[model samples]
Target: MPVVVVAWVLLILLGWSLVYWPHLPSGFVFGSGLDSSARASWTDAVYLSAVTLATLGFGDIVPADGWLRIAVPVEALLGFPLITAAVSWVLQVYPALTRRRALAVRLSLLRRVDTVGLVAGQRSVLAASVLENLAMSMAQLRGDLTQFSETYNVRDADQNLSLPAMLGVATELTEAARRSAVPDVRHAGELVEAAVGDYLDVVDKQFLRVGGSAQKIAAAYADDYGQRIAPAVSGG
Candidate 1:
């Protein structure tokens, strides 16, 4: 990500350097210390570009032409705010991913503790509430990923924090609830399943680009994140 940001800044500087190159010494006001040479070299253009983009107009050289005076400060404007926006984008992404990983951990703990209470055909209101909450969480996660596509490439250092690793657990748990004898639990499960399915569709459509069933897309997502989907039980 930093590479991309740097590349963008460099490309902008290079483009503006080319623009300034054509109008060298003739278009610029030079301080007494600068050489009064008739011809300017490419390095002079690059140096000018660097200073301008850095917003440090070192007085030794300044734009003289009307258009260049406007252009130089424009590059300065791009300098501070453009990089600020990029840094802000990076800062925002992790908070969203933190929430995503937190949800995965919550799902993991639920799976470790209760195997049957959620999906064992029991008509518990608590189970229904859990399912609804999971659905809402998954829905919010989907929205985050959609808005910030770059988060898909971020790798979780911890297995417990990897959403791809626990996504199946969510689906299967929701599946069990959908099969519950209780109507409320089943409805809640259905909503969560839809939520999970939408997230899967987004993975396939935006990032994976491997069109197929949800299972295939989920597998591709896991693989990209350096994980493998855990196999479901035969009956599950």
Candidate 2:
């Protein structure tokens, strides 16, 4: 997301510089102690673009009357929002990324124990509680991915905190919970299953934009992280 945003800014900078390049010196007013040549260098065009887009007029160069004069303020108007959006992208993305990793960590920890067996026993309520939490986390994680689609590109070094790596395990665990005979545990499992399925649907359609079953899409999503999660995403 950050890369895309910054690229947009630089592209605009270059584009505007090209536009202003042909009309420099003659089209613009030159301040004292400046070389006001008929043919200004590319650097002068770029300098004008940088200063104008940043809304920082150094007074060394000024646009004379005509379209060039009007273009200066227009570029300045566009500059503020672009700079603001660039900063906002970094700030907004990290929180969503943090939440995503938190969910992965939670699901990853569950894989360490036999949650299915524990939920099947008389103390099923305790496991059911955990199952409910997992279901909600899955739902929240899905929402996070949807709202902050950019975080999909933000990867974690540790597989334990990587969404694509551990998400399939969450699906498999939820599937086991769904088969339990206990009403509470089974209900919680169903919730988790539904949440996971919905998550698969979102990632498949919006981000991946591929034509396939949810299982195949989920597998592809995990493949980006260098993990084979297709086997675990079977209960789709």
Candidate 3:
């Protein structure tokens, strides 16, 4: 968990540095032309970076030079996606870490059991483990759903088809675990396996969505480049 936190912090800092480091001269206004007095020092550069990246545009300090002006807009563009990626990574990993800790607690309880003649206790342990697994799975699924919801709040059909699909898988697993006569430890494992299979089916569909999106992007780029190069190719 600490590692994930540190990694995200480093990534955010690196992203900020990428946008702000180039114009670090001492107080230079962006696009102030090549000879402008606005040489941005380190502190000034960082301040300007915050304003530009945030789109605050206080207007107290402006980009008077061409590259600085160009750099400002580029930074703004990068800021949105960088911040989005950082937030998304944090949202995904935090719940996963919480689930890991919960799972560890359940496993610790499981490890102390003696396995000899403890039929009733073994059933209890099986039941507890099943519940723990289901809970963890649901937490993760909820996190995914919340993220998808936030990403597209309008709830359109194609906006987020996977959210309900994941919820359905979780519900089914909960139902399987609720079965009273799930039998001994052997069948308990089988029940867990079945639940996992359903979840993985949803995961596979998510991967397919990614591939489909990539293909669309590739086709668009190919068509665009073909148009730009067609005249030159014909002349040649």
Candidate 4:
């Protein structure tokens, strides 16, 4: 996001520079009473552009010519909307990002337990409850991911909260179920696997539409999940 903002600022600066370039010699007035003696260099023009774009109006530089006099105000007018849009985008994405992180943490808890622990005869009830809760969490996460994919059109860089992480969690739950002698625990695991599969189908369609790096990332995730997690989970 910082990179995006910086790129926008640079583009704005370039546009302003071009607008001021032609009238550089006689149109700009610098403070400290150098209005007549000071010629507008590229640096001075850029400084004025930055000030106007930021709506700073530091009173250190002024536009003297008729064209520049009109241009400065227009630039200032554009500044507010551009800044507002950038801030709005960040604000809108923050909640989705927070939810993604929270889901990742919840899913990570499944990693701490071994199959034996989850499948034990005495702990069968606890294991069933855990798998049920995990399935519910994955369902909620699937909704969040769908919303995120629609909004962003790109995969998140954070592996912990990414599609792969969800796959890992689902696979782990399935493996535990297969290992368990208890029928309830196995049923709970099936629920989680079905939910995760549906979620992956949604993601697959989204990535296919987005294409390029996003498609590649989705493919890589599938490969990793299939090769490493699926075999163990399926008892193959």
Q: Judged by TM-score, which candidate is best?
A: 1
lDDT of 4 by residue, 205-224 (tens): 65534334432444555554
- Cα deviation of 18, candidate 1, in Å: 1.8
From the highest lDDT down, the ranking of the candidates is: 1, 2, 4, 3
**Candidate 2 whole-model C-alpha lDDT, 0 to 1:** 0.77
Q: Which residue runs does candidate 1 get wrong by more than 4 Å? A: 1-11, 26-39, 56-60, 65-67, 121-123, 231-236
Tens digit per residue, CA lDDT, model 2, 1-236: 56676787798888899989988778888988877874488888988999988888787888886888888888888889888987887788788788888887776666666555576565677978987887888788788888788777777778778778877776676767766777888888788778888888888777777758756777788887776652232232
Model 4 ranges off by over 4 Å:
1-8, 33-36, 92-95, 113-166, 174-191, 198-219, 222-236
- The estimated TM-scores of all candidates read 0.80, 0.77, 0.38, 0.59
Could you tell me the TM-score of candidate 3? 0.38
lDDT (tens digit, per residue) of candidate 3 on 170-207: 23333444454445433553444454444334333543
TM-score quality measure for candidate 4: 0.59
Put down candidate 1 lDDT per residue, 139-230, tens digits, no spaces: 99999988887888888867568888877877787778866888888888888889988999998888779998777888888888998664
Quantify all predictions' global Cα lDDT against the true fold: 0.80, 0.77, 0.44, 0.66
Candidate 3 or 4, higher lDDT? 4
